[model samples]
Each structure stands twice: as C-alpha cells, then as structure tokens.
Target: MPNRLALKRKSAYLAQLGRCYYCGLPMWQDDLDSFSRAHNIKPSQAKPLKCTAEHLEARQDGGLDTAQNIVAACWSCNQRRHKRKKAPAPDAYLDLVQQRVRKGRWHCAPLLTAFGALFAGHDSGGEATS
Candidate 1:
C-alpha cells in the first residue's frame, strides 16, 4: 500500500525525470505532457516483480513509498521488468534514490515515511510497535 502524498511526490519526481530510467523512452507526466521514468531493471528480467508487481526494487520490498528507495523510471522500462525475482544492487538502488531526491525532495520523503509507518501500524508516534 502507498500513501497519497508519497504517490503525489513520486509522480512529481517522475514528472521531473523527463524520461524512463529503464527503456530510456519518453513518458507522460500529465497526459498532455510527454515524459517517462524507465525502470532501472525490467521486472520481467528481474524476479522481484513476482511479489511486488512493480519494476522498482525498493518498491518491490516496500521501498517505493520511501523516497529514499524510489527512482525516476519510464513506463515501458518499468513494464518490461515484470515477474522476475531479485532487486537491483544496493549501490544501484541508492544511486537512483539519490538521483530522484537531487531536486530537494528529501524533506518530503521523511514525511511520507512517517505517514506510511503510522498508517501501516509500524510507528504510532511512540504509541508502541506491534
């Protein structure tokens, strides 16, 4: 599951990338605007997508909602990677995360983390972890 703000921020980041990270093709940020954020690894080539259903590694393991875990990828690149089972290397994932946050979206990441954690019952403002 993803939080609304996180999704919005990701959409914003994808809007900024201008091209898919995987396929290197143009994608649309807003229907009228043409752009893309390609997946670094196609899920079909990578197996992680089998469980997560997304091309992004971080997202495959609950990392997508975490701004520090997502990357700016295009639709085709993302789609090409479907139903495989391994995440990108740590350095690679980190690189993409850094790339996406280059525009100062780091601040938004923490907010998304807190909101997601709270909603998922991981952290409840010190209420207690179940």
Candidate 2:
C-alpha cells in the first residue's frame, strides 16, 4: 500500500521541480500524474517498506518519500532507477532548493519606494498632501 504522505510528497516534489531530473525537461501534467514515489534511503530488513502500484525498489528499501528524497522521472528512468541499489545523490535536491530560492528573489521596487518615502515629503497618510 502507498502511504498518503508519500503520494502527497511525490506530487509536491514533482510540481516544485517542474521537470524530470534524468531527462532535464519539463514534465507534462499527464506525465507528472504518472510519477511514482521513490525512496532515497532504504529501510531495514526488520521494517520493510510498503510498495506502490507502478513499481517497487527492493534495494532502495523505500525510506525516501519526502520532497528531498524524490525526483520527477519518466517511465524509462524510473525503471532504470529501480534496478539500482542506492538512492540518487543530493545534487538534484540541492539544485531544486537553490532554484526555489532564486525564484523568490526580492523585488527592490517596493523597498525603494519605502526608503524614498523616508527621505521625501509626505503626509500622515503617506501621500503628498498638497
């Protein structure tokens, strides 16, 4: 059974990423809908991870389900990754974070207006009275 958190996390991550990590292309909405949750860290033998409907990675141990843990992958890359034993690296994850931060860059126009008000003449309502 797929965890609700995993499914949600996968959706959020893919939406945030907006592109497939392996393919380096924007993911289509339909393709994104098809993305399955993938884990970066494998769970222990005593506590086996639950699998989803599309596919499962026995070696991955299925611990990773968070935004940082997963990536947007096409069907081919998803299958290729399943054959691997270890989780993908943090570079892609880090890049996503950096991209997000960059996307939120400060717009200085408002700040400049506020600062200019401090130096310029203005009424109590902050507009030129006369």
Candidate 3:
C-alpha cells in the first residue's frame, strides 16, 4: 500500500488538475520524473519546474498531515517558500503567489521566448553561417 504522503500528494495533484496551487502553472503528468515533493518549511532536493507537494502549514508548527493541509506546487515556488525565515500564513502566501502568477513572473515564459529567438534565424538544413 502507498504511504499517506504519497496518497495525499497524488490526490492533490489530481484534484488540482496538475496545476501548481500557488503559481497556477501547469504541471505535466507526462513527465512525472521531473516533479518534486516540497514541504512548506523544508526544502526539497528535487529540481525546479517539477510538481511538488506543498504543505499549507509547516509540520513543525503542529500542522496535520491531512489532505486539507496539502497542495500541489511547482518546485521553484516551493523552494521560494522554504527560504522564508518565517513561513507566512498559507492564505497570505497563496495571495502572493497569485499576484506573481497574474504578473507573468514565472520562469518558463522568458526561457521559452529566449530559445525561440535563438533558433528563429537558424535553418534546419545543415548550413554554415558566413
């Protein structure tokens, strides 16, 4: 049987439609290996841009390991939260994430634009530039 953490994470991921609960970014299920499990108060070893399990309240602060306290988040967002000296209330942190998402501040967009520009002038055929 799967552990409770795994079960909760899976449930949250499915319930949220694979979206990062904080930033509202899409977490692709096709690339499951790239996702991470992040805690509100603890940093995850997993790399960024992956789906992570975020705790609405830190376990150290007497938070329960129930589904209500868990959410799906991207690794980057989760890491940012972990850096906080004092974790903000879940509601406040969520509001901040929503604000950032609305502002289009997530990392993926700019990287995509840059890659597009870099390849825009290149031909698929093997041709050497003068």
lDDT of each: 0.37, 0.35, 0.61
TM-score order of candidates, best first?
3, 1, 2
**Best-performing candidate as measured by TM-score:** 3
Deviation (Å) of 86 in candidate 1: 4.2
For candidate 1, the lDDT comes to 0.37
Residue-by-residue lDDT tens digits, candidate 3, 5-101: 8789778888876656766555543344444322211122323547677888878888888999888777787888878998888778778866655
- Cα RMSDs, all models: 15.1, 18.5, 12.4
Q: Each model's TM-score, in the order given?
A: 0.36, 0.33, 0.67
Q: Which residue window of length 10 is worst by lDDT in model 3?
A: 37-46
Misplaced by over 4 Å in model 3 are 29-47, 111-130
Pairs of residues at least 3 apart in sequence or in different chains that clash in candidate 3: none
Best-to-worst order by lDDT is 3, 1, 2
Tens-place lDDT per residue, model 2, 93-130, is 33543343234322123322322333234321123435
The better-scoring model by TM-score among 1 and 3 is 3
Please identify model 2 stretches exceeding 4 Å from their true place.
Answer: 1-17, 31-59, 84-130
